[model samples]
Target: MSATGVQQVVAEMLQPYLDQEGFELVDVEYVKEGGNRYLRVYVDKEGGIDIDECGRISEYLSDRLDDKDPIPDAYILEVSSPGAERPLKKPEDFRRAVGKDVYITTYEPIGGKKEFEGRLLSYDENELTLNSGKKTDVIPTDKVAGARLAIIF
Candidate 1:
């Protein structure tokens, strides 16, 4: 299967277990580096995820993936926390980051620039308002190439 397909399948497979354990699925990535392929799963919770919990979750997911055999090639599987700079992929992620600092990059320049780093004031379906203290920028959601939690302001 394709990398995207592997990610989707793994997400679906782990959804029930994650929901039951109060763990949030942060993101899944299937990629190749050098000559080795990797399947990485990033997970978190309300109070943050611990190393032991990550091990348990990894073991559980490892078993599930072994059973399913969804991937065509051999690869390493890793499950862990998203760390301090968590990615903002889902709508809920964006909404939760409304009052936090963020680093957002647009596919193209929005206002003669492509990068915006500041406090997120608000987020809606169409756009998000960010205040850099110097100025406030309203960035369209569709233009975002990448978004992540930035250092607290």
Candidate 2:
């Protein structure tokens, strides 16, 4: 199956289990690294996710995947937490990230720049307020091509 198709199938199959366990499905990746194919599921919760939680989720999904046999070829199935620098793929992610450092990229220039890395001051339905050094930048949410938690030192 295609990479996107694989991710979708895995997400659909595992979402119910994750929800029941108070886990959030952050992202799913099906990629080729060197000669091997890998299927990785990134999960998270309020405080964070631990190794034991990841193991349980992995086992549950493994059983389900084995029963359904969704993938035609061999691949690795991994379940783990989305770490500190997790991608903010949804509005809720941005909301949770308020008062935290972030790195965001836009599809096109906003205020003559496509990149914004700073403290995410706030997030409304339509926009985000970022304190980028000495200046504050207001960026439209729709223009964001990518966003992730960042560490600035």
Candidate 3:
């Protein structure tokens, strides 16, 4: 099975368990590093998640994967928190991140720059407003290539 196909199967299998546990499914990655293939699930919830929560999720998913037997090759499974710099993958993520500091990269240059790191003042369906120092930049969401929470010192 393809990577995305595997991810879809895993997500579908795990959704019920995650919902019952009050956890939000953040992202899933099926990738390779060195000679090892890995399937990683990023999960989160209000007030953040702890190691025990991750362990439980991991164990449950492990059992489900064993039963489903989706992937034919040997793969490592990992479940963990997305951490402080978690990615903003969905519109809801962007909405919840309003008034927070963030780092964003554009697929194409906006104002001759491809990167913006600042306080996220607002987000609409089409654009985002960011305050970088004294300047506020209005960036179209379509131009965003990547976005994540930023730790401001």
Candidate 4:
């Protein structure tokens, strides 16, 4: 099956388990690294997730994958937290990130640049405001290609 298909299937299979366990599904990736393929699921919660938690989730999903047999080829299966700089994909993620430092990339230039890194001032449905030092940039929601929490030095 296709990479996106594999990811979507795995995500759907894992959601119920994650929700029951109070874990948030952050992202799912099916990628090739060198000669091997990997299926990685990133999960998180209010405080943080630990090695034991990851191991448990991995074991649970491994069983489900074994039964469903979604992927056509052999691949490594991994489950873990998204870490300190978790990606902001959905609108809810952006809403929760307000007042936090963030890095964003747009599909097209906003304020003559495609990248913006600053404190996320606000995010309404239409646009998001970012304050970078003395300047603030307001970018339309549709323009964002990717966004993530930033660990400022």
Candidate 5:
């Protein structure tokens, strides 16, 4: 099957288990890098996730994949936490991220540039308010190409 199809299938198969286990499904990614294919599943919970948790999820998923035989090719399976810099794909993610540091890239320039990194003040379906140092930028949600939680050093 196609890569997107594989992602959908795996996500469908994993959701029930995750929900029952008190885990949240963050995202599923299928990609080819360094001449190898990888299916990466990002998961999280109320506090966070640890290596042992990832291993347990991985072990369970490995068995399911073996039974379903969904991929149709040789690929490595990786399950882990999304980390502190988790991508904000849904509107809910943006909404929950208010008052947190975030890095955002727009499809086109918002204020003479495409990148904005600062504190997210507020978020709604129409737009999001951000404060970057001395400036506050109001960004249209539709214009965002990518967004992620950021750790400022």
Candidate 6:
């Protein structure tokens, strides 16, 4: 199966378990690294997730993947927490991140710049307003190439 296909299958399979555990499914990736293929699942919860939680999620997903047999080749299954700089993948993520510092890169330049680092002032469905110094930038979500929480000193 294709990488995206595998991710979708895994996400569907893991949703119930995550919901029951009060964990949020951050993201999932099926990718090749060197000679090995890996299925990585990033999960999060209210505070943070511990090693024990990761282990349990791994064990559960491993068994489910084995039974379903989605992938044709031998692959590593990994379940873990999205760390301090977790990715903002969904609109909800952006919404929740309002008032926090963030780093964002656009697919194309906005105001002749593709990268933005500042405090997130607001986030609507289509755009994000960021405050950088004395200026505020309105960035369209479609233009975002990458975005993550910024570590403030």
Taking all chains together, each candidate's TM-score versus the true structure is 0.97, 0.93, 0.97, 0.97, 0.96, 0.96
Q: Give the C-alpha miss distance for residue 50 in model 2, angstroms.
A: 0.8
Q: 2 or 4: which has the higher lDDT?
A: 2
Off by over 4 Å in 6: none
Pull out the clashing pairs in model 2. Answer: none
lDDT of 5 by residue, 69-151 (tens): 98888999999999999989888888889999999999999879899999999999999998988899999999999999999
Q: Number of clashes in every candidate structure? A: 0, 0, 0, 0, 0, 0
lDDT per residue as tens, model 6, 1-153:
888898899999999999998999999999999999988999999899999999999999999888988889898888889899889999889988999999999999999999998999999988999998778999998899999998878
Candidate 1 lDDT tens digits, 1-153: 888899999999999999999999999999999999999999999989999999999999999989988998999999999999899999999999999999999999989999999999999999999999899999999999999999954
lDDT of each: 0.95, 0.95, 0.95, 0.93, 0.93, 0.92
lDDT of each residue in 1-153, candidate 2, tens digit only: 899999999999999999999999999999999989999999999999999999999999999999999999899988898898999998899999999999999999998999999999999989999997889999999999999999899
Q: Model 1, residue 113: what's the lDDT?
A: 91
Give the residue spans of candidate 5 off by over 4 A.
Answer: none
The number of the candidate with the highest TM-score is 1
lDDT of 4 by residue, 37-75 (tens): 999999998899999999999999999999989898989
Residue pairs with backbone atoms closer than 3 Å in model 3 (clashes): none
- State residue 116's C-alpha deviation in candidate 4, in Å: 0.5
Q: In model 5, how large is the Cα lDDT of residue 19?
A: 96
Worst 10 residues of 4 by lDDT: 74-83
